[model samples]
Target: MGVWLVLAGLNGAMAIGFAAWGSHGVEGEAARWVGLGSQFQLLHAVALLALARFCAKRRRLFRPAAGLMVVGVALFSGSLYLKALGISLPIPMVTPLGGISLMASWLLLALAGWLACDHARV
Candidate 1:
């Protein structure tokens, strides 16, 4: 939980900083990528906070969800950031992998909520 909070804070701060940079310093397609990355980072940072709350009750599901989110943000947003900086990597599949991870994280979160609801009914 503590680690999540810290990560959330750092991600949020980076998002804000990147957003500012994108608006002022970046342009064209690079700006678009930076903006997209910043948006994802900010959203996932907030998601991390929500996941922390959910984890208190459903540690099993939420913990893995959090982990997936972290990995997703790292790969997806990280790749976009690097691209924005005009850096290309030899690994072309990284962005797609990150997208899949992000989708999986959302599915896990939904499953966690469903399981919690089912447990409450019992």
Candidate 2:
């Protein structure tokens, strides 16, 4: 619970910081990277907050979803941030992997919701 909350807060702050940089401190390709990264990061940050709340009631089901979200953000947004700063990782597939992870997280979240609802009806 605490971990999720902390991660949410941190991601929110980082997203804002990157957005600010994108808007005022950079231009061209760098700005694009920051813009995209910050947008996804902020969206997921808010989602994580909601997930944290849900975890209080369905910790078993939602925990994996939250974990995957974290990883997705770190990899996807982290790679974009690096690209913005003109740093490229040797691994070219990291950004795609991150996107896939994010998609998986959402799927897991849906599954968790289905399972939780099923259990509730039982």
Candidate 3:
């Protein structure tokens, strides 16, 4: 959890840097991609922080949710950042996989909330 919090902070800082760079240094399509990636990265970093807060109490659910979110943000935003910087890799499939993982993380979060509510009722 501590480690995740640190990661979230780092990610948030990186997002700010990327957004600034996109706005001031880049132009056109590259700027758009960088800005979009920074937005997603920052949003997910916030999510990661929230998940970290609850994970110790609900490891069965939040743990996996956090893991999925971390990987999803890394892959999704990472691919976009790479593209924006004009770097091409062999594996183009990772971006979509990251999207799927991000969607799955949301489902897990909902389930975790449901279970928490059920447990509270008991």
Candidate 2 residues 1-122, lDDT tens each? 78999999999999999999999998998999999999999999999999999888866758888999999999999999999899989997999999998999899888877876757557
lDDT of 1 by residue, 1-122 (tens): 78878888888999899999889988999999999999999999999988888776756988899889999999998999899999997998898899899999999989977876857557
Candidate 2: worst-modelled 10 consecutive residues by lDDT: 113-122
Task: Give RMSD (Å) of candidate 3 vs. truth.
Answer: 2.0
lDDT value, residue 87 of candidate 1: 95
Best-fitting candidate, measured by lDDT?
Answer: 2
TM-scores for all predictions: 0.92, 0.92, 0.92
Prediction 1 TM-score vs. true: 0.92
| Model 2: residues with Cα > 4 Å off, grouped in runs | 118-122
Per-residue lDDT of model 3, residues 24-117, tens digit only: 9889999998999899999999998998888867569898988899899899988989998899969869889889999999999999878768
lDDT minimum window of 10 residues, candidate 1: 112-121
